[model samples]
Target: MPVHQRPFLALGLRLGAALAMSSLYMLVKLVHQMGVSLPEIIFWRQAGALPLLLGWILLRGQMWQLKTTRFKSHATRSLMGMVGMLANFGATILLPLAVATILGFTTPMFAVVLSALFLREKPGRWRGLAVALGFAGVLVIARPGAMPISPIGALVGLASGFMVAVVSIQLRDMGRTETPLSVVFYFSLVGTVLMLPTLPFTMTHHTPLQWAMILAMGSIGTLAQLLLTAALRYGPVSTVVVMDYSSLIWTTLYGWLVFHQMPPASTWLGAPLVVAAGLVIVWRERVRARAAATPPEESAPAGRVPRGR
Candidate 1:
């Protein structure tokens, strides 16, 4: 089947993936609160996923999928991804879940600008407008003087989104030649290696319950990433990404239930605007994709019959 043909199914998968990710972040925040350092969390997170990913490749007899000429590119992508993930997790730990998640929504806006700069894909007027409106929503959420949210936390969150956007660019470049499995495996591998040295200092003794939560966080996060990758492979990023907004819903619900923290009025006010802008951007993308897929009009000389005629 054509990749874009079953977008609704892809949408479901993306939404599910987002929910899983939201849950994972909540767990990460819980463990961090329990005195786990970021490096240790990242190490176990990457390490936990390694076995499942490798097992999948083995079971599917797709070990050759690991072969690639793009090792350098993969390393670069992994480095960016690790930094982005850490920043995002840090924001999650430092800020209220809802606020951090709203800031994370800025990724699409950053992706629009980055695609124009790095990939030479110009976002047309509609998308440009969407980016502006999205940033406006960000400004509303981040009205720094009032101090409803920490300026530093907000900045870190936005930086995380920006770094994730950079990773997206590298993923796009890598997607041209590499399998998604290969890309994910290398990311986990490199991320694990990068976090390993710090693990000595970062590690701490844990109770059985704490250990279980840590393992669960890593397993869920890894599966969520795989689901997200598959969702995009089966659908356009525009379509799949719209479903990611549902993460806010998951985070909001979980934040209240688990942490007893409700989002302030500003978050409620700003988040929908950002989401609306993102949806508009997605609509524009779909229109553009359809236009690109369409054949241009063809005409015959006035005196001649058309082939179908």
Candidate 2:
């Protein structure tokens, strides 16, 4: 079946991805509190997911598809993605779940600017306004002068968002030739390899429960990645991307229930603006896609009017 035929399924998958991601963050915080180092956390995240991904690839008889000619591209993407993951996890450790989640929402805004600069894709008026509004929302949430949260956490979260935007741009080019599974597999593999040397310094003793939580965190992270990939495969970008905002709900609930933390008043005030900006960007992209797909009308012959005229 064609992917665009399953918009509702795509939506459900995207929502599931959001939930999984929120759960992963919560678990990361839990394990970190148990004395897990950042490098160990990152290593477990990638190492644990690698086997699951491998099993899925083999079970689907798609191992051959993992072969790629763009080794350098994969390496670059994996490195950037690992940095983004580290920053995101680090932010989760330093900040409340809801605040970290809100900061991560800046990705689309960054993507708008990055796209214009690197991809040479013009943003036009509406998208330009959207980018401005998104940044304004970020300032409202951060509230620099009267900041109550960790400034470092806020900066790290924003860095995560920027790296994610850069990775998104890289994916745009890679997607032309790479399979999603291969992209994911290589990312996991490379991430694990990159984090291996740190094990000697970062690894610590863990109880069975801590070990279980670490594994669970990695498993949930893999699930989120798979769900996100599947969502995009089954739906148009406009339909799927909007569902990313649903993470705000999941993260908020997790923060309140699991961590006993609530978003500040500024989060309540600024979240809507960021969300609205992202939606506006998605809406514009959908409109542009539709326009591009439309065939141009035939011009009237010479000076003669055509048809009803």
Candidate 3:
């Protein structure tokens, strides 16, 4: 493909991926509003998704490619991913879609901070400033005065953020040892297993319509990850990172259309901060890329800790 065409393809793929993910959130919120507990919603949604992924493996004739040498890494990553997605979905149910979406993008910031602390990677001055500013913005979004905080909702978002950071860490380690698709596929499988123990408590009253919604959630989620993976394949990581931010736009629309709910003012104020955090990461990444474009002055670090992809 031509260079110009590549970006256009990426744009379209990101847009579609955004729509799928935002729609999954919207649907989960709808189900929760209809009286499903968070546990029940998570169990059914992920369980429904498993067979669809199985179908994809069969269709692609790549079932053999599902073999993974990094089972423990995938298992750990999947557990964290499960926690992240459940909390994320629950947050969507309790809060405005836009607010949830905006705060959720803080994943990258959390990724940076966690990487620095755990991976012992140092951030340059500008990136450090960006991380601090982003956390202040999180405070703005979580203010006690306006829109009294829901502890469950807040915890959901924060915990999910941390788990997602862990997911990125595992990905970094495992990406070298396994295929990306294999990693993603296994994450979904492990997530379904992690979500299973709750089934007895989760198996509650559900109308047929609700079941359909849950299944749709699973299908959409699988589709969303596929498109996102494809989008990454098509262009620069920075472009895909920027496009990931567009989920807020889709979630905002979905929130209003589905539930007539609008995010609070503080969330609106914090949106720029979240975006700025991602932009900072992207900028730092570009700087690193340019450095890599040059011959190194000395020996390079081994498996250098990366900014959240």
Candidate 4:
């Protein structure tokens, strides 16, 4: 419970969460390779998480907290989340895991732009520069003229990040009044319901092993979200956000081990730019937060000004 230890605990939790999420992405690719359609895979994913979320709400006696004052906001947020999920799944099917994972790191970059546009939260010089660098990194990985990987897949991954950014803005607005559990519960519920129709036609019979992998993928996803949330709750976002980049390591390992695919030179070269950009954004935000937390000289009451002045 010590203040100093929280950062260490948060870092570990974020690392674990990143590993679990990387595993989930790899599982999605596995199921896609197994011939399941995207809709059905998405349906199962949402369905799998639904139970865990609902159980938590019920067990915590927090069902009353699930009530939402902003149904429209929840619906909008869920819609954006579903689209992001679709794009993410598509990227996994189309691109190598490591490449897709790295591209997804652009979420923070896109979030800065979107926050300015929608939330009117303007980024300072450092974040603006970081966003620019992030886009340049995307260009390096994408390489439109002399494509290293599937260009379409790379674009889809970037699009997914943008969609997630949009959804984050919505969540930020809703979080003003909504409980965290309510936001997650509604998103899971909505995503499941939205993808339900495809289940009947797209669901194919699978072996017991395949079924287990599918379910495990969904369960691991739920666990990943829980760990990520807990990490943010315990430590500053800057500390925890940096740990998310560890997904690149996990995904690269998973790619090599499971699919015998290693990232090309471009990924190795470009990923650092993107990761660095994201870290800059986090650092800038941390500086701003600390600045806000400290009182200005003029705000000091009476002659209480320190001798440092």
Scored by lDDT, the top model is 2
Candidate 2 lDDT score at position 185: 82
- Give lDDT tens digits, candidate 3, residues 110-168: 77787688789787777788888887777788885565456567667766666655665
After superposing candidate 3 on the true structure, give the runs of residues whose Cα lies further than 4 Å from its correct spot.
1-15, 148-151, 172-181, 229-239, 297-309
Q: Alpha-carbon error at 56 in model 2, in Å? A: 3.2
**Estimated TM-score per prediction?**
0.89, 0.89, 0.84, 0.85
Task: Give the alpha-carbon lDDT of every model.
Answer: 0.83, 0.84, 0.73, 0.82
Clashes of 3: 0
Alpha-carbon lDDT of model 1: 0.83
When sorted by lDDT, best at the front, the candidate numbers are: 2, 1, 4, 3
TM-score of 3: 0.84
Could you tell me which residue pairs clash in candidate 4? none
Top-TM-score candidate index: 2
List CA RMSD, all candidates: 5.0, 4.4, 5.3, 4.8
Q: What digit string (tens of lDDT, one per residue) describes model 4 on residues 26-74?
A: 9999988988888998998888898888887889888887886788888
Better of 2 and 4 by TM-score: 2
> Candidate 3: which pairs clash?
none
lDDT of 4: 0.82
lDDT of 3: 0.73
